[model samples]
Target: MSKFIPLSVPNLKGNELKYVTKAVETEWVSTGGPYVNDFEKNVAEYVKAKGAVSCQNGTSGLHIALLLCGVTRDDEVIVPTLTFIAAVNPVRYIGAEPIFMDCDDSLTMDADKLDEFCREECILIDGKLISHKTNKHIKVVLVVHVFGNMADMERIMQIAKQYNLIVVEDATEAIGTYYTKGKYNGKFAGTIGTIGVFSFNGNKIITTGGGGMIVSEDKELLKKAKHLTTQAKSDELYYTHDEIGYNYRMTNLQAALGLAQLEQLEGFIKTKEENYNLYRNKIQEIKGLTILDFRADIRSNHWFYALHCDENYPLSRDEIIRYLALKGIQSRPIWGLINDQEPYIGSQVYKIEKAKYFWERVVNIPCSTNLTKKDALYVIECLKNAV
Candidate 1:
């Protein structure tokens, strides 16, 4: 087949064109406009957060979240090592060090291990969780809803409460995912945390080319994030500034697109869920491969269809990825364990064994909502043949 099956791509099936054209016609193309505010409001309403702040991208949103969480230099933040590096980069952006933690089979931070790390490696000082290294307070716990699978939030939140750590969620891939039963009932993924962020990148379940949004229950923090992104300008008409700021604000054009995309967010979730089920049924029939399960109690948007290579798999992850590439199918291995990366080599990490194991076996398959059933079937066939 000449067609290249991409791992993920934006679905422009909604009112994206109409909204974008209107933005261009109105000349509302800059970082400030009605669309930007409307998009922020739409997301906030959807996630049930008090307020939302749109940023240039998820990384920027995360950076804003870290700043809001008070992640100062050399302070330690516990993060999962098995996720996309984008999720953990914000910890470093705040000049804080990340303490890499392992992930469970659900592909989220292993709360069990995190509790162990906190109880054993961390010391309590003056009602704050402090890392032994650098003697700085370990103020935040950054947890990711990996591959659209909800993390063990109950346990994670419990650990955070017990240790008095602020929870920051990287829900970039799990925007529509939510836990059905918990203290956070009817709660969306990002809203459950102290602060959360979502990515609107081209590769995500939804896209505005590139954008992100920060949400928080604290109204003050949300205002602060918005202020920081818009150069901390004190006046609307006058570009007067109070604090040093960043040009991380989301553009009007992108916000227009995001608003359009948000209208189809539920439809996209349906398509992605269907695609995941199709892949799961087909892959399960083949030996030595299993699709990672979403938590049974929650509904997952299934942003990715991750195939975990069983112990007796015929091909290594690298070999399978190469095979998929040769067939014009784009497959990706999991991100490198963050702690193992050269930039983070000396950062504190504990009980990283499982995360490292996943790094070698997890492969993200094509899971775009734009992928048609026939295209999905072709991928299923290719996997069976390759195996």
Candidate 2:
């Protein structure tokens, strides 16, 4: 019975109008234009990547990244079962199989389990890690930075190196997040991995209406991604094709919006951090409820705020979400485990321990970047009263 609080939404109160108007006035609204190039360059610089290629959306970016990783019809990619379906669907898009792994307390893929699965469950043959279960070559590790929390990239990278796995970071929720106390202390989330992808969906920390970017330290891979996203034309003038490609480039208008969004991303993250702390402070006093934290070692974007409803709490995760919804406040349970989904029912899931625990008890509260302190307190109050 108050102002509706959304779970997450874009903050578009910056140069969005100016840049988008320029694109419209200049009539560079299609897939090609200066804004597109500018957006790519700016994002590359922001993330400290060698280069970035703009794509239609994060899913398409993942598809192109997997294609460039040489993932074939039967190859396997290690992925977290605790992520949105979009993260794993791209594996299927490439006709590859996904070896689902569980999440740790941070809700990111468990690096220790990942290492165990590679060392004890798989075999190394001719410098390739072959899954003994499926007998498929595990060529890549697609790690999603769940809810803007950075995974244990340090340990995961070590494991990846040991097993010859290409690391692809799905940093759709963690654009500005970076390490503060590790080997990659100064690196951004998307830059540390072999290839990284970002999303600008409506519900993400930032939005280009709907767009994504692919970044990589390898310039040649970035170049190939750019080429492949644009129909894989060897000769642009004659439209000559060298290989199969996708029409996945971002439009100038979308890029215009993205460039503007990138400019305000730091500010957005600031708001998110403050609001998240506010939620944490308020929710801590409520019995049997704890606000899930981002990894303490990294500066997170704080994209979404999750609360764990333990047995001490009287409400179920679904009950809390439904109560909040009835009161005009939006909250949601964590995504259903991807491993349990119909498409991935037959896929391999290893040591799914913490994922099942968090999946049932974690409820994400409203955490939009534009959410005010008062809004956050209101949501917290609603939660406290719901109990």
Candidate 3:
């Protein structure tokens, strides 16, 4: 009970040490190594994508995705304001602006609002959707699968197709998530869009210390992504750079760790699902508090469980977070709306109502794969007596 219950942390009880030790013994610790290639292939195969490109991190993978999607300075991308800032930062990284959208109940981008924006806020030119406010070409829709809850991709994809917008899935928190029933049956989170991205951060469901992967059905884009992440060397022998590129390739050591993590990903997801249900059932018995549910149609990773503090709750969202901290339970509020952040203060936003609603009431509770039933019971007891 004295040990802090982290909100989310890596479950590395797999072959992490062995694989990393092998990589170190072989002296292929840097970016260029067999582990990197194997990791990419294994991830793509797991997610059922045609291919995947490993990168330094999710943000870098997104930067490469935006470029591959042809988002330029003259373009605008539709994004959710409710997600982590990293999901929207890549738009700015490419010099393209983001048109912030609101969130639905699932905490993902509102497909209804997105469709409304494209249908009413923008005008279609010669095969291009241009924003009426800025007159920039609305080229892509950057959808984040928030907290491993799959976005409304079925509707979002329809909206994208009707408006000719490229769909980029930020599936960083949704690596093992997939639809059980729908048009996307059997399609993984990151594999549903034109390009999908996944993260392996220290605090994610799995960890590679730090790294990401880009998956796509498009072979050419995958090839170019690998090229761009590797510094666009047309000829490595001569060190010729054909285009501007990034030093975003993942290190072999990270991949070695990732391969091990990937091996146990499904097992981690099972543990997450079990722990999530335990927290949900126990927390539901506490008045004025409820654990938010992931969409039933999809098998989610349940990466981070959301504890909603209704007005009748004994403490406000921030207050509950503080109380949990005092109880040695780590909990945090959902991210501040990205549009309101200093870096994106003046950015365009479309009906950011629900995002604010969720932001004010939702607290992310501990749901790490390694969390045991005893730890979950302790967390629930703290919430039950928080009053």
Native-to-model Cα distance after best TM-score fit, residue 148 in candidate 1, in Å: 0.7
* Tens-digit lDDT string for candidate 1 (132-211): 66677888999999888988888999999999999999999989999788776678889888999999999988899999
lDDT order of candidates, best first? 3, 2, 1
Weakest lDDT window of 10 consecutive positions for candidate 3: 1-10
Query: Of the candidates numbered 1 and 3, which has the greater lDDT value?
Result: 3
What TM-score, to 2 decimals, does candidate 3 have? 0.99
lDDT of 1 at 57: 95
- TM-scores, all models, native as reference: 0.97, 0.98, 0.99
lDDT of each: 0.89, 0.92, 0.92
Candidate 3 clashing pairs, residues 3+ apart or interchain: none
**Among all windows of ten consecutive residues in candidate 1, which has the lowest summed lDDT?**
130-139
Which residue window of length 10 is worst by lDDT in model 2?
Answer: 1-10
Cα lDDT for residue 211, model 3? 96
What's the lDDT for residue 47 in model 1?
Answer: 88
- Model 1 misplacement above 4 A: 236-238
